[model samples]
Target: MTHRTQLNQAEEHLRRSRENLPVAAQLLYAVADLLVDAQPAEPVTNRVAGLAFTYAGLAVLAQYPQAVQDAALDRALAVVPEARPSETGGEWALRLRAAAGSVR
Candidate 1:
């Protein structure tokens, strides 16, 4: 399957597992691992960052340890470009940053 397809499946799993924190966290971690392995390009990187941000937020909501949340946020931030030209990309990066701040 394509990376996009895999990412979509992982995201679907994450959403479906929301009521089960352990499952959701596992899926989120899987998604993060996929993103890391893919090493996606510009616009795709933006999407990956958004997914990571969501994972971090879910980690916080699920009462995960601070280190886990920080790691998720760090992975998200690490993928974001220092300068994204697309408005949507910039917006997603900003949202991720905001989510990171709130998680801490």
Candidate 2:
């Protein structure tokens, strides 16, 4: 499936999982929509930042404590996209995993 399709599916999953939490459900859907509709011509840094924010948003949907979610946010933001231009998506994902783990 296309990446956009995958994102839409993910959004649906998040919505289904958090349907009871109205505010979180809304936030999750909004984030997914933004990711799926992101401009291809946008700068790499912006895309990287979007991924970072999505990671933090997912942490919240996963029912992490506020402290852990904040830590994830901080760690994700600390990744300077411009400085890591050579890193692949998998590498950044690993970093995000480490960031979340570090707080636990």
Candidate 3:
């Protein structure tokens, strides 16, 4: 391949990688938040919708999840325009320890 073509390919790969990162971080923390700490079945539909919204938002912003691909980016973007990463290794750590204790 020409140098120009190689550069384009590398740029595309970097674009996709940057787009995907915050999405994954948001999702891991969201699942950890709802499933790990709270009882999700209490409100039923609303709680489920909240989870779905979270996933949709992340996929729209990050483009990582396969399910979001099926629904298309527009659908995901309809609920939330963007997603951001969660806070880590701070006061939140204390809350988790209080709830479930340490793995190590």
Candidate 4:
């Protein structure tokens, strides 16, 4: 599948995970692992990176272990800071910043 397709699937899993579904975290993690393992050929768009970061931040907010949250945020930052809101990022960027703030 294309990177976009994978990203979309990941986004869906993340949403379900946010709703406190027991199995959703596993699905989200699987998608995250797949994305990490299958590094994209071309750089992903800022929006896509921003979404990933937001998801990671959400996981942190949901009280996943500190190590897992840190790893997710670290990976997200490595790809794109996504630390603040921007024209390109909108709410996702804001959500990321909020998540980061809560972690501290």
Candidate 5:
């Protein structure tokens, strides 16, 4: 099953404000929770900033740990196109579900 959690706080934040970090932070938190629910074996953390471009989808930013840097970059750089959903609530969750599936 594809599970997508809508960060309404983030969406609300985006709508009322142009703050990126707060929104991105919520995005990151949602992603982390999604990953755990999706696959418990794999652990992902946002130790550094992350980047998700329209074409690139989602990519890890910031410095990576010594052992995982290259691999993380490789995985992050390979993401397909992605964007913030205009649809509120469940729509955003589905988008995240799709993105997670794409990652797999």
Candidate 6:
């Protein structure tokens, strides 16, 4: 499948399965979807989007019942220190941590 098609599928899956996920997981997935959906064109925008995607995905994965390897969370944790405050002064890393903590 084309890259855009794959992204669309992933977004649809997230939307359909969201109710089954913890609130935090849903939020993180939403962030991931948004980052990919933007289809960033600039180099810097692309880099930021890639980081957001990895951070969001890893945060969600770390919340799973059986939880993936510690390396996933470690990578996600590494991304947090690089996060800059959003234009509205919100912190994405904090939101990600809250979501990871919310997993059952």
**Best candidate (score: TM-score):** 2
lDDT of 6 at 2: 100
Q: Name the best candidate (by lDDT).
A: 6
Tens digit of lDDT per residue, candidate 4, span 1-104?
A: 99999999998876675555322333234334333544433344555664653664564435667666556555534433332333333433344333433322
* Model 2 lDDT at residue 27: 40
lDDT of 1: 0.49
> How do all the candidates rank in terms of TM-score, highest first?
2, 6, 1, 4, 5, 3
Clash pairs, candidate 3, are: none
Error of 6 at 97 (Å): 12
Compared with the true structure, all predictions reach lDDT values of 0.49, 0.48, 0.41, 0.46, 0.38, 0.50
Question: Candidate 4, clashing residue pairs?
Answer: none
lDDT of 2 by residue, 1-104 (tens): 99999989997886676545433333433333443345323433556557745763764535667775565445434532332565554444444334433332
Candidate ordering by lDDT (highest first): 6, 1, 2, 4, 3, 5
Model 6 misplaced regions, further than 4 Å: 1-13, 39-102
Q: Give a tens-digit lDDT track for model 5, residues 1-104.
A: 22333566666765454223322333333553444344434322232113222212233333335445444345433542243333333333345445544442
Better of 2 and 4 by TM-score: 2
The pairs that clash in candidate 1 are: none
TM-score of 6: 0.33
- TM-scores of the models, in the order given: 0.29, 0.34, 0.23, 0.28, 0.27, 0.33
What is the alpha-carbon lDDT for the whole of candidate 3?
0.41
Give the C-alpha miss distance for residue 1 in model 3, angstroms.
1.0
The TM-score of predicted model 3 comes to: 0.23
What lDDT tens digits, residue by residue, belong to model 3 across residues 43-99? 224444366546535644354557644444343233332222343323332333232
Error of 3 at 4 (Å): 0.4
